[model samples]
Target: MIIIVFHIDSQERTYIERITQDTAEGIKTLLKNDLEKRITSLSEQSKLSVISSGMSQSDWDAISKNLYGTQYGYQAIGWIDSTFHVRKRIPKHNNEVTIDFNLALNPPALLTAIKAQDTQQRAVTMPLAFIHGDEGIGIHIPIFNANTRGNKLDGFISGVLLFKPYIKSVVPDFLLNEYYFTLFIDGHKVYSDQSNQPAIAYAWSKSSSYYLQGHEWEINVSPNDEFLYIAHYKVMRILIALGLFITFIIVLAAYTYLFARSKLKDERYKIEHLLKNLPGMAYHSSNTINRPMILVSDGCENLTGYSRAEFKKNRMLWRKIIHEDDFKRVEKSLNEAFKVNSPFELEYRIITKNSSIKLVWEKGGPVSSIFNGEIIIEGFINDITSIKEAEADLISSYAFSDAVVNSVVEAVITIDQHGLIQSFNFAAQVMFGYSADEVKNKNITILMPTPFCDQHDQHLAQYLKTKQTHIIGVGRELIAKRRDGTQFPIHLSVSEIQNHENTMFVGLIRDITKQRASEEQARLHTEQLAHAERVNALGEMAAGIAHEINQPLTAISLFSQTAKNFCEKGKLEKLPSIFEKLSLHSRRAGAVIERMQLMTKKGQRSKEVIDCIFMIKEVINLAESEARLRNITIRMTACDEAVDVFVDRVQIEQVILNLLRNGMEAMQLNTCDNGSKIELEIKLNEDKNVEISVTDTGAGLAQEMRERLFKPFSSTKENGTGIGLSISKSIIEEHGGHINFCDNKPTGAIFMFTLPIYEKRSRE
Candidate 1:
């Protein structure tokens, strides 16, 4: 018995060892594949940089900025002069500084490749070190000028790599911790990972060397013994127990043989009885239902709640036992089986003696009757009532899921792994103007335009190969084609689900055509309202602007007449001075009218960074004549300082003019006994914002008027369009500012607004 058990144990051990060896080999292959793939990718990227350097100067200039340090590793590229001085560096230095390649190159990495100057286009790697205070690993690919046949190397496309991240990214930390590993490049120890005082020792190891891009990497690794022990511990115990049980059974074999002869007869009789009393009904009946069954088993009691005697007497036709709905199905199945002489199997419902329905599966075929030599139906019936109940519940759930798909407003579509449409819901049918039957088995590209349609298959095929997805599990805005060939913007979100053997994608799409149209209309309406406000402001100040221009015209006329008089009296010597005065006033009148024309220009608003103080001073100059006519003295409290804001200059000027004119009118409505004053003030606030305020001395605004002052179409003046203050509020807010009301110190309303200071960030 001991010898027998020993043989079994040896066989099991051999099989287990073969499986363990296979697993270890598989792990080694996977690791080697990863290392080679990553290194090959890095080598290809270096060559691409060399290619870009040869293309054009602009492409070369942008190399450093485009380098992905976090994704790939730290890197740099430069152009070197014949003197070995770095002439251009990507991700430029903070200040003008030169890198002397003569000192930066160590014993033999980049220096050897540069000095070789051969046309073979080889790559060299340099160790990490600080050259002028920056530490990095450099890989130099020599760039030779393409214009000349044997031109000297122009420069190098350098790769600065972070060692630890670059190495572990290809072979992760988990792999390092699980196995003992050492890596060498060019006979130098680049990285070595091993656990000291490991739980188990390494009993075996594997070593390999790979050469890539003229560089050699040697790798040695060994599996962890403790992990292998834990993996096989329970399996060994199970096999040992099985071997012991088999040995015990072998020892009892002789004793069991002696008792078997005596008990065989009695057991045969019992087995015969058991065979006749199986669960489910068995029957042999004639082809005609009116004939009595040739033989029926006792299981008819459980199957139909009727005795075998009732079926043998032909008291009821076997066809009448089938449920009403399933009568035709059962007859059809039997007819097909008889015609082909094949096995008959069917699932249908039957009515029991108590009028209760029980789902049953019947299986058998036509056989020759042993007594009469006539064909007969021989079959067994199994009660499948529970299975039928489960099917009913599943059908109910399918109905609920269909209801949900039909209720959604957005189009929902499902596609198979081949990009063929599998399910198109009601919304999708309506959106694409195609029914589910029309689009079924069609590729999803039919609903998309050129570039998207062409690239979709490529994207899907790549994902199937690499298991990497960019558009799946995200929402993207794209253009979709309708049945009428019209293209419109749609928001689409796709999700992937993997079921058993196939993959499926579900996409939800929403049409955004109306939404985009509404946004454009709103923007156009805003521009039209701002232009109208500028025109209205110019209309209110027309008389004052006329007076302002007439004064300059009057001066020019007086100066010209004086100059002519002097010429007539033979006083040509004074003519030069008079002529100078005439020229000054002539230019001044032209300036006034030009400013007015700019303020009311009918066009789109243009935004730029302008000095806020200078613009306010200009508005003040434009409104002085009107203020003086109303007996209001306009004063600038702090107009000399410089503050910059980004805004539409003309629109901002109109806002300032409207406020000053509104203040002057308010003062006139409630006349001040000591004369009215409109003062303009600007100050830089603690929050780095420009605050401008217009104050007037008059009867203050009523509590009721203050609440609705900025609301559209609510105004204090009868002739006012009621949109000026509202439009002013919109303009200021659009420029990243807010305008509102404040109480003046001496009992009047002050209109105050704040604007963000312009910040220059293009360089930073």
Candidate 2:
């Protein structure tokens, strides 16, 4: 009994062993293909990195931004005989701060490539040796320069593939299963699976091997023991069936002698009839060369498309009927089964009479005659063509679905109705720095920060009860947490999907950090452009400013001379008024220069609650010079009443000055009796905020000008940068104010802006 049971167990073990070996081969092929492709890609990128090191900075920058057109992620560097040097790298985190490949002494492949001219090589992985503790696998291409004498090796261009994460990011998540794997570098093991044990290939493990440019990876994969439990159960069932068969045979032989000859013959015929009506053929073959099919049921001809006589005569023999590709496997399995004296179940393809193929399963055991040493093989063979085809279709459908999910660029995730994560794809793994293996069946809130995580269950509960949507259907920007506990912006869109007995939430998420960064960068560029325009505006008004200062200086000089003359002639009465005028002129000149200086300076200054009256007066003073030169008389209303408003001083002044100058310029096109009056006003508005307006009696505005008034680079002035009004609008909006243009009374244009009131603490 023990021997028989062992026989059954051993055959199943052999079957499982074969499955594990095949799985290893497949894994090996996949890994080798990926690694070799990576080597080739790095080699090509190395050439570019080398050649571009001597190119101009701009060209290098463009190429680096594109990762040198390589599909995989690697940092490229050029190698002089002594050291590794980077020409450029982009998404620039990979930029090498230090150059030290130590290629002359380590990673023999790099040295080999360096020895030859323009040769490419792949080298062993070195742990945390490059750029932020990353496993760097060296791929080097020798670089050359043609001198006056001959072409000589200039250096080697090297690309260091950040190996670990690169592999994680490229390989499908489904493939990273429980199979224990060890990645060997040269002959030394550098990486292992989650098992973490350094294991050599076992009889059950699968191995993948890759060798290129003197570097290699021998990958061994051993399927988890749990994966073979089904086979173990099948072996138990076969052993039980064999035991019962022997017991029945012993009982039948005793009964056969007791029964009459006719009764025995009748029972034999009844058994044969029962076997013939079964789903498959029942057969007993002689254990001889050619394995002659001496007896077979009627179903044999139906399954094999051969007549009963043909099978009995061994014309269309069992061995010859097996498909060519499956013949060796079937034969090997049978040999192993017989060696263990076990019953075997095998799947093999058979060629039919019409030359079509049919998949079949054969279950058989060796039998020996009791009276003599005669040996026979008895078995049942069944056509499993439809079942196999259906299985293939099912597998194909699963593959298709997996492909679609993996192809999506977004980090797709699915969670159970209870908020536990059910699915996570490759993108999700890359985005969160967590493998699916690490997070599967974990709470979806693991990807969220404090408040979101805390509130997630409530949100789902609320949704289930109310069926109202907040974050469903629409994509909204939110912060997501990574495995490292860092937060990043993600655009999340989620929907409810029903899965048989439960509800699941499918979330489509995308990292929007780069997009937000780009927006911020654009805003800064706009601010810089505005500052340049302001400086340019200052330049345009230089002559007018000089004229305003010259008048004050001329008045001061005249008054001083007059006072001196009075002193010389003993006329002291006229000196008092002259000194007063001189002091006023100096104050006026200083205020104009100071306001101009503040407005033209670069960058943002902190906002403050500035006095509205004071600000209006200063802006008018700055523009007063240009206003007079343009023949525009400045008038003010409500200039003395104190009102405070919160704003950036320079930015606010810039808006006011721009409005004043624009009004003055407009008046240049329309001259009035009072020389194109420009009115500057400051007062409290209905909103209890400070309102400042610049009104002009110029040509006012054309319909088109009014429409595009606050648009950047939209101008009517001959030498206008067209940035002033647009910048003013931006500043006003940023300060929580709104600026607008409207008709001034009946004949002019008024450009007005309002600033929020500064809320001072009320007296207790």
Candidate 3:
């Protein structure tokens, strides 16, 4: 019932006395003698020793109580059927377990060691017990026994028993049964029946390099095989299967896509047979390719004049075959197409092997992405020489036609069906006082005066309706007003000109005011010379008539004188009648002399400004006697407003009188039953020109004679001189005007003369 303990370090035994209450030798001797006797006595179950010995009193007392009964003679010994070594459970970490012992001593007993073969056979020596030696002072240690007591014996011989190694050191598994078993899973508590029990010690069984005599022992279970197996095994298996399946699908899809793409490309190659034959032609833009070229057409040979073999030997041959001037342009277009990813087509000239140039048409577009580079360009080329030549010829022809139009002298203007001037020549611009830029698109009627405003439009409508052209075919001499509001005569010859498919009119215009003026002056000059000659002859003829009439008058006078004397001697009234007859014969001789004198005088003066209507009235008055004799009425509507004109009054009046006499002669000479009527019209025109017209209703002048009516001696009268109208023109034109002869409606000729009016000076 007593416990004894000792701690000894044999390597440092100098401190053993301080650690232990007894000396080493003294304790050894006391334990060998007295401790043995006491132990024998205890084994014999006798009374305790009371002699003075090497042991302490407390030790003696404790040992005595454990072996014998107490002082009461009460028996303390008891026989047990079974002995159990209740050990504390070991803790597991990784795959091992550790048992920590809490004995009452620091050093356990040392003794001879023995070996156990297996776990079952080694159980008897596995559990340890405490024992005292023969010394009076004894220490405690372990014994390898399967059964042991846990009374006051635990105060000594305390050491570890492990079911497995400590996971850090190697220990015998037989001795491990000294400790209790425990089980855990992933740090979760399971079974620990002896978690709080003390660890049972085992005695050193043998002296071997594999075992320690007085050291701790540990138990171990490998972590890889125990807890971790159940924890992550399921997750690892699922992940492995899923990864394998995903890898299979990815590989299969990649193979299928490559195979399909290859088949599609092969089919496309057959369709583009021409593109495959050309060797140097590239699909993508590169100098060389392990892959086949794209869009290389067979016609490439014809275009470049180089065989496929020659180009394949040198990939740059295709570029060399292109015309030098066109190479840059083609390269620029290719670059642009690549940048924009759009289709491109163009025509350019390319040089051939024979040093001849061929016009080639090229087309290209972008293709796809490759190896982190956009090196794709698709294109084709072919000859286009014929097409380009045709375009050039058409352009040349247009230029020639334009030259002809620009060179015309007359003011040529072209008008469309709408009457708008489309093309106006230089002359047309100048004549119309507008630049080509100003009037090219203006209406044709812009050159016309008002009221004649829409007249051109109406005329065009009439012409379109009637299918006849009055102004188109023939040149019409007409008067048109200028931009300055002055009237000028011009002859416009318009013709309908047709183009490739449309109808247009070209107006050829000329100014004719000068030409007409020249004709008038020539006619007057001829009339003046003819009139002078006729007047000279008429004077000579009148001289002969005067002489002949005077001789007859002398004979008649002598006969009348004799008759008068005979009547006077007879002294009858018959003498007075005879005298009256002699007086009448004297007056007749005087009238003949006066008529001859008037015809011989030829002192004519020039023209001056005069009142035209007043002059016409005086001329009518002079012709009145002749009109009355023919039973004719000469009517006059001379405007009462004074129409002052630049002309000779005498010559204009003479022209009027001759026209009146001619009308009377035509009436009498034609032997018409009703006497003729004459009409005279005079008015001042709005343009400051005077009009004097003499019209007769007698037989009209024939068209043929009217053409020459103003010529000298070109008259229809029996004794007429055409000098009167000729002189009238000469005088009127001296003041810058004109005379015109026309036929009056239904009959006679109308003589009309226009004289420039004299504008009076302002009174201021």
Which candidate has the top score in TM-score? Answer: 1
lDDT of each: 0.75, 0.74, 0.53
Off by over 4 Å in 1: 1-74, 80-135, 138-339, 345-361, 366-436, 443-445, 450-478, 490-519, 538-700, 728-764
TM-score of each: 0.52, 0.39, 0.32
Candidate 3 lDDT trough over 10 residues, lowest sum = 201-210
Candidate rank order under TM-score: 1, 2, 3
Q: What is the lDDT of residue 299 in candidate 3?
A: 57
Kindly report which residue pairs in candidate 2 clash with one another: 24-206, 28-208
Off by over 4 Å in 3: 1-320, 342-347, 360-407, 457-468, 479-487, 499-501, 519-764
Q: Per-residue lDDT for 1-764 in model 1, tens only?
A: 56765775676556545544544454446545654543444445545655432345576655544544434434345555434455555545531343445534555644645553454454545444535344334555455557668765566555545455555665656666656666667777665566362534444455667665566666666556554444444555666788887888887797689778889888988865764787788888888744357677778888898887888887766788888899887888888999999988899998999999998998999999888898999988879998888999999998999899989999999999899999899998889999999899999999998889999988998998898878798789899998888899999999998989999999999998998899779877877887888777778788888999999899988888888889899999998888888888888898888888888787776799998888898998889878878888888877456788898899889899999988888889888653577889999877879999999877778888888988989888889878889888988998889898888866887898989999777422
| Candidate 1: C-alpha lDDT | 0.75
Error of 3 at 489 (Å): 2.7
Q: lDDT (0-100) at residue 41 of candidate 2?
A: 58
- List the pairs of residues colliding in candidate 1: none
| Model 2 C-alpha lDDT per residue in residues 409-518, reported as the tens digit of each score | 88999998899998888889999999988999998888999999999999999998898999888889999999989999999999988767988889999999999999
lDDT of 3: 0.53
Q: Put down candidate 3 lDDT per residue, 708-734, tens digits, no spaces.
A: 776656767656665655565565666
